[model samples]
Target: MFELLGIPPQVLFGQLLLGLINGAFYATLSLGLALIFGLLNIINFTHGAQYMMGAFVAYLLLNLLGIGYWPSLFLAPILVGLVGIVLEKTMLSRLYKLDHLYGLLLTFGLALLIEGAFRQMYGVSGLPYPIPDVLKGGQNLGFMFLPNYRAWVVVASLLICFATWFLIERTKLGSYLRAATENPALVQAFGINVPRMITLTYGFGVALAGFAGVLAAPIYSVNPLMGSNLIVVVFAVVVIGGMGSILGAILTGFGLGLVEGLTKVFYPEASNTVIFIIMAIVLVLKPAGLFGRAR
Candidate 1:
């Protein structure tokens, strides 16, 4: 079928697979962005830093404590989330009453500081994280050879995305969060600990970025700058999907990833700018974003 378009099946499917993998990361990262924006009303510029921290923590665990990717996979996010908890309690919490731009500026400064510290320590070179033995091989599927690790990344991302959506969009806890976002004073009047919930929500959002970081460590070089470029794309995804729309963020993340991948196959030069182009069109056509509800 692909041959009809002068493209090989391998080339076509390969790009698609790659796109899905990129989408997975985009989905996870953007979900966190939406969550923070929705519940906390803060734009966490530190998210990319937290993600870089996740990869660094994984690297540290493996080198210093003799832990591997599997254990670090779970531990990295938890550790980063804890750091987020501290930041929320000490810094982010105070900014809640201020303008949202203050939060963005503060977090952006934090991001730069964290990235600079890591760069000072590790230098600009990317440290390598080997793929685990369990996911070392690839299977040939006639059309293409599917990598075990890449498959795991996509599957894990999907599961994580769905699980987060279910938890936030369906559960009782989610109900409280929505209510609190709507009116914290009213929710507090009803006996919910809205303040604490806000803190946790920020941590949880940061943890998602950390989660993406851990997943990305093996695929890309684990470096301080790893999250820099990616976060811009995720920000674009948030805009395209409608900022603060959780499900919209997830769907748009994966959808754009596929679009990006296909662009690479069809028009290599345009691949880099395709997402931005979509963003421009979306801004003009639907400034509220594709899934965003107007206030």
Candidate 2:
């Protein structure tokens, strides 16, 4: 087996695969944040809690209702997304005219409250979610074995990310969303329901988070704190990609995942911090982020 940089091929490739998997999750999660901030102009702090809710929903569907993975994958997101829509209509809608800090504080409080409720109910232990029967195995690829589920994650995340980008950048409804964000009064005058669109956009963005959580349930132990643990890193990814850059989030996510993966191989001590180091460098050099436009 050929070695790269004197490291065993299996070890290097294995870590890279793991990194890609991590990146998939990062990309999926950050994409949601970008959409919410970009279109709705509200920083959703409850996003992580929403994500945790998705996983718990899936678990409940499986254990309580005897629903399996496939149905839960679609259903969990919708249920959680509807909750987001309600929150938007009742709470987040009120904060749009306020400073960004207000939106941030409100959502942040919501996140803490939601997480605390889940903790009180479930405690801190992780609940196991079984991988679906169809996606249970792995394939040997000479240098490394690839798990079917993880590969599905990467492919699925990429598809969802790209689809979202296309919808926002290339489609008519997406055009209305972008336009409404820029000038809601003008868009509303054009006979478009700006408030409704904003509400739907927030719901859709949150749905993306829920979708990621479903993908994550089997891989990570589903716990109340799961989303909290990953969210800080995902936020770091959003900052590095730019506050509202959708494409930036996707590319930077996968790129950082690879970088973090390789870091683990070359220098395990710095693996956890490499993304932040890169974030610091990016902040210093290009404050708008790699793909974000200067405001």
Candidate 3:
């Protein structure tokens, strides 16, 4: 087998693939965070809870209604997005004029409420979600065994991330969203329903989290506590990526995941802390993040 830097190609590629899979989740979650922060100026602490809710919702659909993975992929996000819209209209709207910290506190409370309710019902044990029949196998790519579903996830996430980036950064509706984020009053004066837009944007961001949960359901055991573990690292990803740039969030997410994977290969002890360490270094070197603009 070919070798690079004293490592076999197989090992290197395999780790890289795993890194990309992890990156897909990080990118999706961070993209949602970036969108919410950009529009609402609030860190959505309930995001992880929403993600957990998505997996649970899928499980419910399967058990009660006989819905499968493919359907849940669409339905879970819609249901979760609706929940987000309700939260925004009923609770989050009231916090708009207050300090951003108020929004954070409100969402943090909401996260606890959500997680607590689920824990009460489901407990902390993980539930298995069967992979769809079609995507349940792996392919030999000569150098490594690549799982079909994993490859699909990486491609789908990249497409979704770039599509979101293009929509927000290139389209007219995106222009309105950006404008509303900058100055809602002015956007409202221009005949835009700024409040409604904010609500939908929040829903959309939450929906992205839901979509990720669906993708993750088959890969990891579904548990009330799964999102809790992942969200902290994702938050660090957001901080390192910077809040102002959507692309920055996507890039940082994938980059950090790969770095973490590499660390696992070379220095197993540092895998968990590598991302945070990188965040500290980034803060010291460029407080605005790699792709972030100094504000």
Candidate 1 has its poorest 10 consecutive residues by lDDT at: 1-10
Over 1-295, each residue of candidate 1 has an lDDT whose tens digit, in order, gives 4483898989988999999999999999989988888878888888888989999999999999999999998999999999999999999889888888999999999999999999999998999999999999999998898999999999999999999989988999998988887888999999999889988998899999999999999999999999887889888888899865678888999999999999999999999899999999999999999999875
User: In the order shown, what is each candidate's alpha-carbon RMSD?
Assistant: 1.1, 1.1, 1.3
TM-score of 2: 0.97
Q: Tell me the lDDT of model 1 at 37.
A: 86
- Deviation (Å) of 4 in candidate 2: 1.5
Once fitted onto the true fold, the runs of candidate 2 whose alpha carbons sit more than 4 angstroms away are none
Query: Of 2 and 3, which scores higher on TM-score?
Result: 2
Candidate 2 vs 3: which has more lDDT: 3
1 against 2, candidate with superior lDDT = 1
lDDT of 3 at 143: 88
Cα lDDT tens digits for candidate 3, 1-295: 7777888877877888888888999999999998998889899999999998889899999999999999999999999999999999999999988999999999999999999999999898899999899998999989888999999889889999999999999999999999988888899999999889999999999999998988888888889988888999999998799877888889988998899889877787998999999999989999988877776
Error of 2 at 185 (Å): 2.0
User: In each prediction, how many residue pairs overlap at the backbone (N, C-alpha, C within less than 3 A)?
Assistant: 0, 0, 0
TM-score of each: 0.98, 0.97, 0.97
Total colliding residue pairs, candidate 1: 0
